[model samples]
Target: MNVDLNIIVFGSTGLMGTAFETVCRKRSISYVGMSHQDIEITSMEMVNNVIERYNPDTIINCVAVPSIDPCEKDPELPLALHCTAVLHLAKECAKRDILFVQPSTHAVFDGLKEEPYTEDDQVKATNIYSATKLLSERFVATYCKKYYIPRFPTLYGLRQNNSMGFVDKVITWIREGRDMKIADDKMDSPTYSIDAAEVVISLIVNNEPYGLYHVANNGCVSYYDFVIRIKELMNADNNIYRAKDSDFSSEIYKPLRTALQSVKLKPIRSYEDALLDYVNTDVIGVSD
Candidate 1:
């Protein structure tokens, strides 16, 4: 991919977007990152104004209400960002013939299947959050003919306020000398934020085909394994870990194994190694 290509990234303050911006800056790729302070995507007027001003070759919307409980509490908010804002952005992109990319999630599946879900797997969203994301995907498919959709799973990197990212949260708990509680039944292939950003940038710069594709780090593991891995990486005691799955439903109705396969795109590296790199980097929560 050419290094001089310009790209406009939304949700710039988010875990994925922040890592994307950092990668772009490190690579000297000409790009602009936008947060809510820059332009509110929910506002059609603001979306239009920003698009008109930048006229970027591509627009990537990373905005998403990831907290499942919050989404369940207020479905309207997720609908706004995931469905409404997506529709508006799709219309804008269609009108201008510019490439649009929407970063979707793995929650858009039901955990009924025993094997990994392919792109063709039937979607059975079990919660308001997943349903909203599915609605957004439908809208994007219908309106934006020239667009890319990279469905991501648990992207953990440089999350703002350290409020999100299961890995970061676990590290914070350890640093704070708190015991960790993890779900043993829940399963997913957590993607490193850097890997996700790199793949998305590759798709944009390479003018890759416009379609739904999964982008996640390789290797599947339970939440318990994820926690154990983090603790091990931090050189912390494993006894600090505890597991429970009975309350997962009350928190977020998630697919037990929405571990996606990115067979079409270049294969993602293993999460075991990726996690090590992530913890060692300054981007993620590192105790100084």
Candidate 2:
């Protein structure tokens, strides 16, 4: 891998963006990370200015809106952040022949099947949030010939700034003994942000073939049991109410089972192992 390979990471202040920055620095790869405040991806003028300033060979778009409960009622935010912003980056990267890295979620799957989902699985988005995400994937593929779209089941990173992610919040809540409705049936292949960043950035550094890769952890577990493990590992206890995916049918768009596997890339560690490592080292409270 070339250490001098120039890369630009959008959403640098977010979980996945921070992970990519870490990996790039550790590997001695050259890169620039941009937050939402640094650049407005929705505005093509800002995007064009940054492209000219950096003149990077690759652009990784990590901008996203985590909250999705009101996505159907209000598609404006989700559409702009996920679809329109992606459109701008995709078009620019395509025109400049720059490699485009788009990180996607497991929500793209319908979750009707119990088995692990692969990159080749037929994507059936049940709600507006997933629909816009799916639309972004199409935009990347349609516009950019050289692109890397890796679908992760769930990515858990540091809770330093943006502390709204489920895994970190659960860890904080358990330590603080705050109650949360834990879903016993909402299955997902939890992925560590560091591990994901390593795999994805390496692929880009090596300039691998452009296509979708299921870059998720090995096994899957429900949200309830996953939280239970966190408490056990931390030598703490909490009384989280047990619930099922159907309990929050409103989040049906999120899908209950989104276990993912990679047929195109090397398989990473298991979700259990990743969670343990996270709790032992990277875990922090929301207030931290």
Candidate 3:
């Protein structure tokens, strides 16, 4: 990739987008980060206007309706955000001969397999959110000639508020002295946003093969164990208990385990190490 290559990042205000922006800044990579307020993704006119103005070498789209409940409650909104808008962007990238990078989640799997899911594994979207994401992935693959789809698992990092990442919610609960219970039955690879961002930057700079890749932290753990690790790391005195997936009721279904393993690229770091870094950098100032 050329050093002078211009990149455009959509969904710039979200956690993953912010991480990508931070990485781009540190690497001295030129990019224009646009939030939803700057450009409505569901509108083709807005997307085309931005593309026409930037004429970037690459377009990294981080836009999506991530939550399961919201996607289930209103299906059309997520469809527009994740699938329809993505097709428009992919078509534009294809026309401009630009590389399109899309970040996806591990939720595309059904979690029936005991081992970690690979990029080639058949996707079984258990919920509306994952279904939309899977559809978006297909649209990008079908329309865009040059594209990179990196699937990730549970992600956490700095600048992430309570609603975005699970780690932030845990930290908030600890600070508020609220008793919490996390599901022990559900397992996943909790990836750090910074590490994930680094992988994306590496793929772009190295001009690696264009296909689906699984980018995640080194290992997997149940949600309950992850919270326990967080409590231990933060030294919080709050009562945190373990619960099974059956304990909770939701309108949308979630896979019990969606741990992702990357055969294409080496894993970055352990989830424990990543959590420590996040706590030291972002959560140390909060009162417990």
Candidate 4:
């Protein structure tokens, strides 16, 4: 599993980005990690410079605003980061014949479908985040002839920042014996970032056909259900209750069901298996 493949990864400090770095380091893959400061994505001049400098064989652009509420409230920055920056990167990848790997979200679908979503399914963006991301996919498909758009489900990993994801919070809260109210109605495939990192690397290393793909754990689970499993694993005595998304009122609208299923590639391990690894190994303490 070793060869010559120059890779450049943007968003090197994010949850998914860090996973990629870890995987590359572990596998001894040749990669140059770049954070927001290393290269300002909004500017095309900077992008061109970096591309020329690294001259990577593949460019994995994980640069994205992974939040629904902010996108809903103000769409400007998300549009720039998600859509405009994407177009720039795709254009560069097309010109240079660099394989573009973009980790998109499962939110592209409206979430009305009962079954897990596949690539052929119709996409309906219900929020600004989805809309911009969907547009980014179009840009990549249209511009970059060689590209991989792996639509990701709810991804979780060790966060370097003070803020933590839902999974992290649940782990901490349960350990502290804090009362919790999780959403039973809403369902999402909570995916592990490390697994996603492997999928992305495999696509490039194995030279898979360039196109849209779904990279998620086998099935989706409700917050209540997920927390229950965590509670059981930890064996903590804390109140964890089932509630609906409607219970807590907010302007942001996330789709009810977004469990991604792949038609092209075999589905990764189940959420339960991945979760077990995260709970047992990662165990990053006290997420803010």
lDDT of 1 by residue, 1-288 (tens): 338666788888888778788778877888888987788889998888888888787888889896678898887899899988999989888889878888888888887777666788888889999999988889888998889888888878775533566676777787776776688877888888888888888887677888999898887888888888887778776465456777544666656777877768777789998988988775344575
TM-score, candidate number 3: 0.96
Tens-digit lDDT string for candidate 3 (247-279):
998756788889999889987888888888878
Q: Quote model 1's TM-score.
A: 0.93
Q: What TM-score do all the candidates reach, one by one?
A: 0.93, 0.94, 0.96, 0.95
State the weakest 10-residue window (summed lDDT) of model 3. 158-167
Runs in model 2 lying further than 4 Å from the true structure: 249-252, 284-288
lDDT value, residue 61 of candidate 4: 92
What stretches of model 4 exceed 4 Å from their correct place? 284-288
**Poorest lDDT segment (10 consecutive residues) of candidate 1:** 159-168
* RMSD for each of the candidates: 2.0, 2.0, 1.8, 1.9
Once model 3 is optimally superposed onto the true structure by TM-score, how far is the C-alpha of residue 171 displaced, in angstroms?
0.7
Instruction: Identify the candidate with maximal lDDT.
Output: 4
Candidate 2, number of clashes: 0
On a 0 to 100 scale, what is the lDDT of residue 87 in model 1? 93
lDDT of candidate 2 over 1-288, digit per residue (tens): 447788899898788888888889888888898888898889999999999999999899888877567677788989999998999889889999999999888889888888889988899988888999999999999999999998877788773355568776787688788877888988888889998988898797676889898888788888888888888887776777799777765633567788999888877788888878877776633334
- Clash number for each model: 0, 0, 0, 0
